[model samples]
Target chain A: MSYGPTPWVQRHWDLRAAANFAAGGAGSGLIVVAALSGARDAPAAVALLAGLALVAVGLFAVWLEIGRPLRALNVFFNPRTSWMSREAIAAVVLGVFVLRAAWLHATDSPGAVATGAAAALAALVFVGCQGMILRAAKGIPAWRSSATPWLIVATSLAEGAGLWWIAAAAHAQGTRTGLALFGALLCVRLFAWLAWRRSIARNARASAAMAPAGTALSVLGTALPLVLAGVAAISTSPAVVLGLAGTAGALAFGTGIAFKIALVVRGAFNQGFAIPHMPVRGKRA
Target chain B: MTRWAMVADLRRCVGCQTCTAACKHANATPPGVQWRRVLDIEIGNFPDVKRAFVPVGCQHCEDPPCMTVCPTKATKKRADGIVTIDYDLCIGCAYCAVACPYQARYKTERATFAYGKAAAHEAKRHDPDRLAVATKCTFCVDRIDAGLAAGQQPGVDPEATPACVNACIAQALTFGDLDDPSSNVSKLLEMNEHFRMHEELRTGPGFYYLWDRSEETGGVPALKRLVEEAMDLA
Candidate 1:
């Protein structure tokens, strides 16, 4: 009478999946922290350190899911043809830039422009790779569209801005950049909301399952932080009290991840052919 | 200045994954991860089935979103229009990961080391930082850099042909400078019915695919239908 496990869900949510969710959450948190702090001189440094640590952990989780880990390098040979290869190469380049920046900071050298540019490029490629990975999967209609990547990028930006505001309250010099980042986060959230609404409305099946949850997270989980950040920005409140904005921001981030994980798991399998039920007959024979 | 680009004659593509394999070998990437992926798409009902293989990678766009959102600025576009990433500088925020519409970037995980002891050793050795940042195609920047230094054309490295081009047994992948009118890629673009991925996004992708004249000829109709349906819903 009842169908078995749903194809949409992975067999057992393993370390890899957990790590992915955690990484996504942490990455978003760090970026938000950096944006809130406006530690321009050290924002990239902090972000790189946090980002890499999470990525390394996430990668390890992925290895746990697979049989062969060494063959991973084989993913990078096809920049001319493969998104996976390009992603590998980009990660290497981004790492180099991060190290260079760190070295410059340590040596008191003036390499911010070069390093910042490199990080920017790396960020774009990073998001692109995420979308490509989803697109590569033929079955997941939810992830195939261009909107997926854009949505990812928008969420990161929003989270980064939220984090920046929180950190800004801790430092005297970061107030301006923190507020600017808050504004940016608000804008990105708006864009992301629009994109999600559009996508959900467009796909009936996707809308039926994922859209309601996505809308809740985007509207409540994602929006609440920005609203708090905005309030903190405008109100002449004490820095200590305003710090609560960051806490709110972090909570919003968790909600965002919840929404993302739900969307991801729901769309894992293709809409397989509906099973036909057997007809019960008695007198016909 | 090396303005890197690629042109694919979709007409000639038979959906073979030579380019994928070539890329795998060239990059020495770990398993369960592909730098280059060939998408085999089928359209229409059983009686009127239509299949198309879409090979996609980093478009290396002129206004790359990844660059705009990077809190660390680890990725960059060169003066010659080739987008490159500085691996050492990347903190792996994956902010760039989300910014990109094409989904061209990836987060290299530590699990990559589990493929083999050798790969694990290599990961420990080469990427000691260990998944500390975002990554994607650099248009073979190392090869291009070396080629330029050697007074040869950029992206002309015999051993490093951007894995997909080399792996493409169908000989469907063509790499060259789009700026040069004489380049094979340029000529192919001019002669064939080519299209870039998500052309509407206006990312100005570095890669192009030539559609088969004899096939449905149009772009993936199913996608087109989806787009239309999305528009109506919106």
Candidate 2:
């Protein structure tokens, strides 16, 4: 019954692939959101290193998934057509920009903000490339929808905002802006997920599994964060506001990781064969 | 200028799976792997039902998504329209496997034999280079090339034709140059109504299925008219 007419879950990319997408997306989001919030000095350095480290872990996970570890360099061969190649190029660009921004922050220079801004642009490209990579997979109906890239970008941005809020709270910086950004992005992410779910045909088993899981994630990840952000916005006590924001941030970030894991592992199904017309038996020719 | 294509007559195929067995025997594919496959499809209610045996595999699409998504450029389409994979250059990332809508590509990480242990012949013929890499049906490219070098026509010569085509007991499968108007496949397509699987995807698959006789001219195919004319001339 292997690879029958019925759609089957793809086993080629497993938990390792899920890890790459989850961590890489969150890290890229963090870098962009941190830069946007005008984080500098000690906070900026932390975001730079943390984001790069997360991306490194993601890359390492994919390296482990590859069969030929030694020939990993060959992935750069086809940027003209392959989105994976473009993602690699974007990662390299982001790394270089982050390094430059980090150096500026270390020197107490005023231009670190500008450098961070440039790094943020590169980080956006890195995240966008990741979305495109998923969209490019024509075999998996769940990932092949045109709305997939938009959903991915929105979720990644929301994830980044969540991480940024947590970092701001940890550094004792004002987290009001981060909280507001996270709330706005959470709404956008929810809408994007809905749009994507509606657009794709839910014929495959993977699509069926993705629907309930995605809906639950939207409620838990988006609704909870929005509520926490709202309460924090109106709260008079500084400690209460910070506490709620931090908790909300943690929840949002954790949900993003879980959603990505579900997407890559639980929701990747191959399109099985289809016979459009059937031949009749004992028919007059 | 040559475009290799296959046309399977649905009415003629009996679902015997001889082509599938012949393909596995010719390619020495692993026990679980089938480069060529036959699907037994039954449709509709019991009183008004239909059954079909569909032979499916790599269509060698003109716009193959696998080739486009392969980051290492290991998957390539030859000039004669055969999609090939370079195992040495492949990084075994499985990107091509997911990108292939036909589900033709496969990646095996380790060596596996038909039995629990490798037979003497299996061990000798084991292809190490194919391990941990993307693999698919190549349309028997080696035989085609060898036959061409020996001045034999690919579709006309038994040695040049694909193993599946030669093994078809019902004469259901036809392989030939699509570009040549005189080719058997071209003539069959011209005579009978045919459809390609997933043609809406715009993959431009090289495989065709002659599902039913043309309704025009009282369901008498054009090829039969041509044959009748030839007989009268003789």
Candidate 3:
């Protein structure tokens, strides 16, 4: 019952917050990556639509996490001091740009590239704000470090590339670029995750729970995904390349979701209350 | 320049948990929720072991991480160094709950009683709407404000003081204006050897612990000081 000095958190943020953050990061990354790649055709469009839908669902999940869902609008009222508010504003900007891009493409208009670029920027901002939300919470020593935001953004980049690769895997015409991008993003994710784990391990107050997630992320998330994507990018065999790309996509997305759950859930152990003195066994004075 | 603070004398505490009960009764906290609690930890090896009682709730820190990360501006610190959560403004986002380094905040979705469903006492005590929001020790702000308005002195008047301070059976807890050197808490801090919880975090907690006079001042050697110093390095 006693937390000693390091209180084990009783799950302040349940599965809902984790799901929302994962979806928001992966979905936003998907939109940005899909746009930058030359897959502006049917598959990329599908991924964009799905990504936007996931983001919308993600926002709804946050609404469900609160006590009064009606008061959720107040979350966006304070952008000056609150990263959560800034995230809402960025979400709004992203929604508008993404919708505009979709409309232009639907109407066969010429301004989709411009709209896509804007949407990508907004999505990146939203994802960054989400990471800053965790970084801003100083109570969780594992999350308060400077590397948390970078790790989150890096994971999002890999997840987005994985998602885009999944959508465009059927057509080998534009798969190499997405696969190569996926490998690069995996490298970024690995570096950031390693740095994050090192920082957390060095913290005197941080629990040892996340050291395992770091290993997990490096293996299943970065190493396997990169190896599979690298092979797919250079492979001449269509069957082998497509199979490997699918595996890479699965591994990348799984890593993103798993690492986020571990970070937001178990990484949230309280730093514990500290004391300066102890009473002796036999003394009242 | 009114800064409210509490001074807990470790030598006087018997860990009776009277303050814990009094806080729950005064706040009408839910059946499982505790606004203030006394934790008993056994320190040192068995042969030289000693039991220490720590009365903990909120530090009500100078740099309250809860207030900084609050998305709705619902958590705020008043001019008197008391941190409070505005129930009306809080969207029940538990960010404040997690942001608290002391794990002081509590959130309960349902109003339950000790015996069964809502008893008559629970019905009278419970604020049904407070279920979703972040809640912690308010330092009995309502009583302090009402008592001040009525020209009663806080820390001296029972009605004006925090319920936990008033209910302490051992009189181990002292509360007063930290801004005034003449106040009970301030005088105690000046006259005794004291340390704050998590001082290295630079939170500048309003709560202080007066363990004992140091050995250099002709008192017993402070094993507690050695333990605290080693932890600070860790």
What is the C-alpha local distance difference test score of each model?
0.56, 0.85, 0.81
Q: Give per-residue lDDT, candidate 3, residue B232.
A: 100
For model 3 chain A, give the 10-residue run with minimal summed lDDT.
A276-285
Ranking by DockQ: 2, 3, 1
- DockQ-derived CAPRI band for the predicted complex in model 3: acceptable
* Root-mean-square deviation of every model: 15.7, 1.9, 6.0
List DockQ, one per candidate, in order: 0.02, 0.71, 0.48
TM-score of chain A of each: 0.77, 0.95, 0.92
- With a 3 Å backbone cut-off (N, CA, C), the pairs that clash in candidate 2 are none
In candidate 3, what are the lDDT values of residues A207-284, reduced to their tens digit? 477766767788988888888877777889988888888778878888788888888876777777667667432443
lDDT over C-alpha atoms for residue A149 of model 1: 65
Query: How well is each residue in B1-234 modelled by candidate 3, as lDDT tens digits?
Result: 999998888878898999999999999998767888887877679697776788888888998888888889888899999999888888987888777777888888766789878788788877977888889998899999999999987898998999999999889998899999889887677756789887877777898888875434314334565567799999
Model 2 lDDT on a 0 to 1 scale: 0.85
- The TM-score measured for candidate 1 stands at 0.49
Which stretches of model 1 miss by more than 4 angstroms?
A1-200, A203-206, A214-285, B111-116, B119-126, B154-161, B213-234
Candidate 3 residue spans exceeding 4 A from truth: A1-3, A170-173, A203-207, A279-285, B214-234
Clashing pairs in 3: A5-A272, A6-A272
Candidate achieving the largest DockQ:
2
Predicted model with the maximum lDDT: 2
Point out the higher-scoring one by TM-score: 1 or 3: 3
